[model samples]
Target: MTSDRMTPEVLWSMGRIGTFNVSPDGNTAVYTVTYYSVEQNKSHSVIYVLNLNSKAQTLLTTSPKSEYSPVFIKNGQKIAYLTAESGTSQLWEMNVDGTDKRQISFEKDDISEFLFSPDEKLLILIKEVETDASIAKNDSDLPKASGMVINNLMYKHWDTYVKSIPHPFVARFNGDRIEDSTDILEGEPYECPMMPFGGIEQLSWSPDSKSIAYTCRKKTGKAYAISTDSDIFLYDIATKSVKNLCKQADWTEQPCDTTMSLEHQAVNHQQKDNNVGYDQNPAFSPDGQRIAWLSMERDGYESDRTRLCVYEFATGNKTYVTEKFESGVDQFLWMPNSKNLCFSGVWHGKTQIYTTNLKGDVKPLTDEVADFSLVSLAPNGKDIFCKKHSMKQADEVYLLKGNKLEQITFENKHIYDRLTMGNVEERWVATTDGKKELCWVIYPPHFDATKKYPALLFCEGGPQSPVSQFWSYRWNFQIMAANDYIIIAPNRRGLPGFGMEWLEQISGDYSGQCMQDYLSAIDDLKKEPYVDEEHLGAVGASFGGYSVYWLAGNHDKRFKAFIAHDGIYNTQQQYVETEEMWFPNWDLKSAPWIKNAEGQMQKAFRESPHLYVDKWDTPILCIHGQRDFRIEYTQAESAFSAARLRGIPAQLLLFPDENHWVLKPQNGILWQRTFFRWLDRWLKPDNK
Candidate 1:
């Protein structure tokens, strides 16, 4: 029987594919697939290999322990991956045909990530080393401490404490057994790949395999508290020496000049103290003549535009390759020919792949409305392998052969064939200031123009990030539409894509034009004959959650209910409490209590959600995770308490183990169920 509607279970059952690497010959590709079991309430990943010629796929690894980051080595005849089969995650290798499996690295600590050298004789690995003074590297070495003695600002990160710092190590494979291991980043007070959300992309190997380029912040102790100045460093294997590739001249100790503006002086002083600005995702050219990486201008601003830069090895000069490109360059890879580079960035509400030459001439390689993440480029430089996804389909591996694109994997086909997905369309609504804002509207499944449906306006979290036409595992719109609710996601001002000016408009004044833009979109959405304006509701997470709170207080009568997940309750508190101080500092223009021109407090503090609690009368569902350090759990507690104190219907969903996002398989289902039930309670009373 054909499936009638898509449910949370079906979405969870489908395999989630990630990170593939093509063989040197480009004839085979190895990728990882993760599947979750609801009964076990856990997920495990396995590696698979696909033949590009015959489109035949074979399972390579079937270990109960999860295996990930599969890459071809030994002249494309062997594969290597990371697994915890021996307790801690260690490097494992096997033949191309899945035979002769053997463990490679036997380090006491688990290897976080590893990459093969171009010659395949050596491996570059990143592992965690205990940095906390009280914690012993080996548990048996010393008695266990009951409590952690904190000495630094970054003692605790997003979801875990700073027990260890990530360091890079080099190991040589002597054909029989791996030997000659060395820690390259031992003395430096730097974390390669930088915390929170960094992976193998932060490290790059030169074509000759003699030098490795990696990104790291040199700041230590109290200096790391307010600065995010990271730079690319080149490490030589033979000499064991490191040199900063993007270091700037000393400027921190300069006397205050009366001619310079205060803002300019402050920025220069910060950079002088921090040295190099934020640089990440280093990619070495095929010939090893130059290196390309992403660089940000300001020192303490994490939201600054990421411009692409190239550093020449011979001249020791750096040049900006994407100065004219308005959008930030997120990821890029050097072409096999070493003359061109392929990158993925947000453009007009969608992430597309583009190619740029050394001289800065850029051309769009893929212009589809869907989002595309570049996986690997063919060795011949003729085919591009990418993972593409849209609102109607989950992410699947696709091969771009010349102008023709062919889907190579059917991992999600079983789920896709049975899903009755809604019709998705992009609409532009006029804002109050005569500006047009983009919004994506997903009509309910089996939608009828003559029938009215309750609308759910989804507030995208980034405030700076866009709600692109991409598939989301957590906030899947198809499942919502299957439940007969119209989904509307608006790309308000401050969201990426429509240009930097539009993105910066909502910085200091988050509740100003951006809020009006959301309101305008809702008003325009209400004009549709199929929209049920009386039962409309709003939902958001992070910045989006902040928007929902703002709406509850100011536009309470319009939205029947509001759902804020891990939102900010008080802006002033968020500035100090958040782990990354650069975000709030850049957005608010200064620290809290700093006055603007009129001698008033910063706009961010003045427009905090906590101050307008008296006006919040609408029912609200607040969700928070205890481990969410980005936006503390107290934000949700305060919001839920305020609503209850005001005698308004309120509910709180707390996840003790989860972080900012509800990532666990069972918790994800519970979150979805709770979300739908809350909407049903207020928006669709008859259905309840």
Candidate 2:
């Protein structure tokens, strides 16, 4: 806490702000902030209710256990949230003043998430349901058996095996408690909210509260693994019937369906089009006339552009509202008038707010160089409330009134005021393909031009994710600068924010122009006298990790050190080892065993980092988590093995109790420490 510069402990000490919900009358807002306890190796979340008018924030929960996902209920008189105070997760309600806390749902199962209907008569509860029958625990003779029978391809997902999946259940709220709950998915072996990342956002209620719209991919096992084909379903409460809203044009070719009715029900016409990819997060209009959700065009491509699609309830016509935006919409809010929708999207290295009408006419609301997430609108509907953050700062609530963005909740202001953050500058570097790509440059706190400093080339992950003004707990640019290393993050090929052409360029050509762009950005910066060209390093996670591995062999001694976390060392092994088959099938263009006439697959597999280990001479550090199914730990293990076998200086950091991301407080600290220790050993030789 006494450090003037950013450090691992300092970064972990800062409170992280999460999702918030505005009260009914828009007078109060309840949000959650999570704090990590490194000593305890855990974290806790606390909820707070803020008066939007007075800007007075009050802590609503004082329990030792974490309380989060707060929403205003009973006409803003009570705040409802989920907590584990009773050793099991359940719904708890309290007054706006944080008194009279009482448990509502006493179900035997834990409620992962919950959403109340607009009329407050019905409640949607999300809980895990064990559908797989092959588990050893279910056998009468195998009471102590811990093995799982896997007969299908999606047996394991992001971190855990496919034993239980989340399903949405509809229950009646009779004021005091939830009752008469029934699983909307009944006996289906599918995930309603999906897996890994989906939550309550995938479920919504209509204005009348008689129907529930939920997102579900009704496929199981291999079919689920190789497709991104999720659909929106409308479930009627009275008849207990479900209808597929985003049905395929060819019903016979449909991978899955949730229709429970035998006869054709005269309702809103089904969206029978070739709209295949991911169609989820259905949001109903205030007037109950339309529903909007983010949609992707391709079926297997996960990084496809997420267009905002609206379905008119009256006409049964679906319209792509923000097709011309050229990028994906991250989050959106329906205007009070219901004629327009405001959304947040990345464009030119910034995630800004934009307003679009039903006619596809878009207007920029805020063009600042920081990332903004759409929260809600004011009572008057003209002003917008959003969470804004940048590379130099964490998340803080902001009110966008007309054109001005005023900071409302300074959740991390105390930490920010005490720390000296590095300055983040935006630069445009010319790429090897003759394109000007956006790159972010971070300088040390109180930077001096007379001093030469080591530098790091930050390769972005997601492969398609933008190198925007994002604030992160790990891979933080400001923290790297605080360590006395200038950081260059380039929005290279395959990253969004630059049109589809640039974003799609790195799909099959992983070791192509994108790697050159990383070199381009760092090469352009090394020309500066203040930058120590002799002490350059490259680092990344996921696909960015893949970039570092590829660059280790192709960097031509331009980099002194390399660090790859959960990256692919062998493309052939990754093609079958990854849980999501669609990712590899689409990005790598084909299975490794198949003969791709275009030679794309051959090129992709041939360029695997394990194959080029002979050229690796720089000191490299490899890290991975055993639970990470997306990119298995074997990838990192093989990379480290090959590096050492080639007589290169190498180190391996493995985390057994972690997933694709190092989530635990203590594990995260270890990651940062090992990260710096490796970099300092090679890149910071002068300082050592």
Whole-model lDDT, model 1 = 0.83
Q: How well is each residue in 138-216 modelled by candidate 2, as lDDT tens digits?
A: 5878878787777778888899887898999888898999887789998888998999899999989998988999998
Worst 10 residues of 1 by lDDT: 253-262
Worst 10 residues of 2 by lDDT: 258-267
TM-score, candidate 1, is 0.95
**Cα lDDT tens digits for candidate 1, 188-269:** 6667768888887899888898999998887655456566678888999889888888775543423432211223446544
**lDDT at residue 353 of model 1 (Cα atoms):** 84
What are the clashing pairs of model 2? none
lDDT, model 2, position 306: 98
The list of candidate 1 runs beyond 4 A from truth reads: 1-3, 133-144, 249-265, 268-276, 596-599
Best by lDDT: 2
